[model samples]
Target: MLVHENLARLLQSYLSAGLRSWVQINVRSTNQFTYSEFTQLLPNPTITLSFKINPLPGICLLEISHNVAFAIVERVFGGPGSDAQPQRELTEIELGIIQRVVRDTFGPMKEAWRNVAEIDPSIEAVETNPVFIQTGGPTEVVAAITLAVEIGEHLGHMTYAYPYSTVEPVLSRLSPQSWLADAKHMSPSEEDSLRRAVQGAPLPLTTLLGKTRIRLGEFLALGVGDLVRLNTRVGSELPVFVGNKLVFHGKPGVVGDRMAVQITRRGT
Candidate 1:
């Protein structure tokens, strides 16, 4: 339960950012089903995404409703999001496009479970019809998480199913302590990586000399060599900026053959 709730929060925020839209997610139901039963559980024409979680024995499954999947596809293609269902199997071209969203369904799992264990989940396959995939034993039980996703005026559901045997070993690790630890501390490697990324980033540096205002006719009638008046004194200090924000003050001067600003003071 803790795992599911945490996953929901991360998934909602991450997906909303990626899709550039408002998205709401909620846990609709939690239950268990036998492997054979689960395979046939979703409606026909559903998009089935399979993933392999490292250190786990079997592949996990994600079932998305036809309406919801189609709505997402339409939204990606610049259409107003639709709740209409798709009546036929997706073609190769459409599948290529939708595959990105399919792969991202479990993209948040690794981060959500990082404190408990560093797990890697890779896409195993995407099946338009569940009947085409070969899965586990008929009697194996799988835990299922049904979630309702709301986008605009449309509401749809997506389900994530994990084999009971595969996740049973790490069930004890999904606790409040793990979540708190993740929130309280950034690992040493993570901190170092963040620092390096900041250090490597490039910032645009520029110096604003002065500003002036003139009438439309005066501007239009100006010649190429004509000098325009500025609102600053000849020897006054000018403001230096880095990516829009004023960072320091400098004096205008010449460096060999080029014009320059010599830094005189820092910005408050």
Candidate 2:
């Protein structure tokens, strides 16, 4: 769970944005469970979907309740998205609606998974009963994310399960810290964009009037009006520093009412 907390949060954000754009619905992550524990939590007559990840040769499961499916179907068809749970399996129209929802979800799902690996998931089949599906062995370990979906006034649960084997090859990249560390290396375009962004940023500049060491007692006894003699003469060009780096040489003078430095030479 320690390693997954960050990934979970990132996935939650991606899914939230994806669903909001596609269906105008909101989703919140309630909890996570292991595969064995999650299977035991499935309700009877569950809407089970088997998904296949291309180029990885792996399968996963997606589950939603009948109530949630019905609500989504209603909303997709320009209805109020409120109704009693249907007693039968999804009809052709309902299935068609759900298929679109599933297809749209893959975009964000793949993007959230990019930190781990590039996967293309497609729903192979949808089954009403979990007993009829066999995406993996009964004992296979998986990470299941439980989501609280809100469609109108009805609230429903949706679960997404990913088998450990499916993402094992890229597990090292899945950690949030690792993913963020990798993000620190920017592409040339990104670097250029960032450089442009900070080009106008302000910097503090200071002139080196000169420095002279004094005894601790002598410095402590200095008075407000006392003058401390410096090593440089009054008319000598002063080295200018920008945040500690000496970048220019300037001559000090009084401009209008304030003292100023006019740049005379650039740093070598």
Candidate 3:
């Protein structure tokens, strides 16, 4: 259940996008967890959605607090979306709306994980009692993400949990480093943006024409315009360095009135 931090970021983006599309409201994922920790975070009387993720052996859960769920239902009915304290079970219409929310959210959830996994997430059931819906055992680990949803005048939380057993199949592909490396190659626009940003950076370039050993006494005796013999031949290739690191072999030359180094070999 040790999810890559990049995966958390990806989920956040998709969750925000998915929620906005369905309700036309803001939803921000502000927290995350591994399954073992998630069990302790669950609140009583919340709406728990169990999902059967195909090809993965276990169930995943998405939980929404009553306040947030009621607010969403109220808003969908063109109400003012104020906070609601639901003391009773949801009505049939409310349940339908909640189901729609779950179904709509799956698109972005699946999209976010497309790179790491092609998860087919479908709702198995919706429950009000956390005791009845077992996300995992007390010590079981899972990847979990929490969202802060805004509806009209209220803000509430929604949490999603995917058990470690369920995600183990694709865990290797979810490493943050690997994901970043893949992202760099997958998006040409991102590559261009990176290149453009680095293009303006200034580096100190130096061409070492030659080197010679000399005593301190001989060095101090030197004067301006004095000819000092070098260890290199006139036609030899010089080593070119950028910030003290040798990057190329070049030949010292004159370019249109300016002294320059014509690169002959690039570094490995």
Candidate 4:
């Protein structure tokens, strides 16, 4: 129990800080099963993240329950993380959102395992289906750690499966003693962390003024300040985007010295 509790406390600190939410993690059960048995235990439509520890030989897995995934999605979109647990798998957009969080969620493993061995946990892939995942031979031992994940009023589960080959080298020093809370009062990372997580990423603001087709002769003959009619009507709203996503429509304007766009409406 102490072992589980210590690891839980460690993860609680990391997740709370990264997500900026009150998250409680308690290890529900721990086991060592054969790889074949491990496959049987996975939920089909789960968040299966494949990762590897530097200096270790095999890929490892961490499966998150759907409830937790959906809750994270809702919270990131400016809603309370508590939502009705759905029976279906996550959508493409939902998967992308969780993938970002998962990347952040696992990066701290290297810190937690520093005493055991200097290792790095790098997420290799995220999949909803586990059909093609392979961590080790069918008969190899797999250590599984299942935790009860809670955020607000919603509750779910997360299971981590580490193959023997991956953790064997560090087994001697892997102990709950190494994972005790660094701070007695570890608080959630800055207020509204989810909002800041997304806001910090750089976004390109590209404007599409108009479109037109020109023949070889016409395009070749174009000169500076030449007038060319466009498909769009004058004074029409221009489309502003980030990559392929249309974020908004705006009208062109100028302020003292800089040309700018005044958003007319949000994109659909």
Candidate 5:
């Protein structure tokens, strides 16, 4: 389910936003299997998408049933009533097309996650093979994408398995700790107020203040009572900013033997 959930999220991001609502993804099961061995286990009529990620077993797989495959192909090639049906058997050309489409869709999703997770984005497509599956009486055709995610440590390394039904559980398990831990992380009013507050805040003045400058000649010319003209003006309320925006204004004051800002005005 974890893999399925990941795939669904990935699919949602890969496909057009308008198409997201029309598609459904489910996780069937998840297990650990070797890339070569997994491919051998696939039924005759299958579609595989292959890509590589170095420093680990450079493979991952996305398998889909025939019904799903037809649906996807129909969508990609336009809609139903189109001439997308394979003649008698699935061809390598058809498999290649499926692979390209899947690769195009998933490549950006992988990159997006990589950026968010701070991982490398060096995966390359190797191949996409289609095979046929049979369960009982010709249930439907199936396709799979076998991707190389990383270089394998061993000659016959095992890869993670995420069949289509376990997406929700996996996503639940990987949900952000802070969000999961806090029941009331943000109230509606608090979130709305924060949005409004950020919108109304004044722009940062740090750049206007400019950088400090001091030359060796000037240093030698320094004397007692010599004033250093700072960008800040005397008696002017100092701005307190975070992330380059004014949050508060105050005058300098002594508090408990420490210099502190005494609030003179509050930022919006």
Candidate 6:
């Protein structure tokens, strides 16, 4: 039960605040910790981040499943589908991306620790390895990112080993207490104002008729019957350029016989 609660908190940390999406963690294997192994009963692929405090040689592993990893990567890449398989083996580029993500997710916690404990936490990437496990008699593979945190040379070579289960209690103790416990206590006025702002945001008015060019002599000779060719192909969504930047891609339309455009997608 403690393991489940810790896993729940870990999942919440990743889903709500870390990756900002719903995710699940399934622990598929374990060596010594039974409470830690309970997470393997879940149905998601697990990722374990192992951390070692200097001189200990021992490590603490934070395990999360593969499904969660793919979900996180997809979210960061602004892609769809959480089940997409990562191509090839883990490369340095992929490891770097994962490191940045971990840093981003844990930056606040690290900052909080720095402020309170005055301990300078150093995170180092030791390895990004793949582990295979059998779940319900089915084989599953997961990619694990290992990081080492050196708290101090002393604590005398002591390995502060904490599973997701053990660390969860520590996390709970550190969680902030909210005075506004009810939704009713929150400011509805701010919500209404934000909604209004979103609704009132101005729509792009600029339109693109596609690329055009005119020679000096041609421009001088231009008259009412002069025809200018635009580079855009027919039936193609025109790119609306605003402030010389492509902002919207849309199909030309007509509103009450006046030329208009139905925006299809926004371009950043």
Error of 6 at 79 (Å): 0.9
Cα lDDT of model 2 by residue, 137-192, tens digit? 66777877665555555667667787878767777776647745765785665444
Instruction: After superposing candidate 4 on the true structure, give the runs of residues whose Cα lies further than 4 Å from its correct spot.
Output: 1-4, 175-268
Per-residue lDDT over 148-265 for candidate 5, one digit per residue giving the tens place of the 0 to 100 score: 2211111111122322232222344334453335335656753553344335433444323323579999989999999677778767777766667777787776799986777777
Output the TM-score of candidate 5: 0.39
Please report, as a residue range, the 10-residue window in candidate 3 with the lowest summed lDDT: 1-10
lDDT of each: 0.75, 0.68, 0.67, 0.74, 0.43, 0.43
Candidate 4: deviation at residue 236, Å?
A: 84
Top-lDDT candidate index:
1
Task: Estimate, for each residue in 1-268, the C-alpha lDDT of model 1 and write its tens digit.
Answer: 6556656666777768766678887778999999889988776776788788887778788887766676677777777765566578777766666678766755677755655667778788788877885567878899999888886666788898888877888766666565445554768764553344335444798998899999999999999899999999988989999999999999999999999999999976
Worst 10 residues of 5 by lDDT: 149-158
Candidate order, TM-score descending: 1, 4, 2, 3, 5, 6
Clashing pairs in 6: 27-39, 27-40, 45-65, 45-66, 46-64, 46-65, 46-66, 47-64, 47-65
Name the top TM-score candidate. Answer: 1
> Which model, 2 or 6, shows the larger TM-score?
2
Structural similarity to truth (TM-score) of each candidate? 0.63, 0.58, 0.56, 0.61, 0.39, 0.33
Query: Which ranges of candidate 3 are over 4 A from the true structure?
Result: 1-41, 83-87, 136-138, 184-268
**Of candidates 4 and 2, the better by TM-score:** 4
Q: How high is the lDDT of residue 11 in model 6? A: 34
Over the stretch 147-245, how does candidate 4's per-residue lDDT look in tens digits?
A: 899976779888888888887786654654432332233335422332333344346799898999999999999999999988888799999998889
List the RMSD of every prediction in angstroms: 14.2, 14.7, 14.4, 20.5, 21.5, 18.3
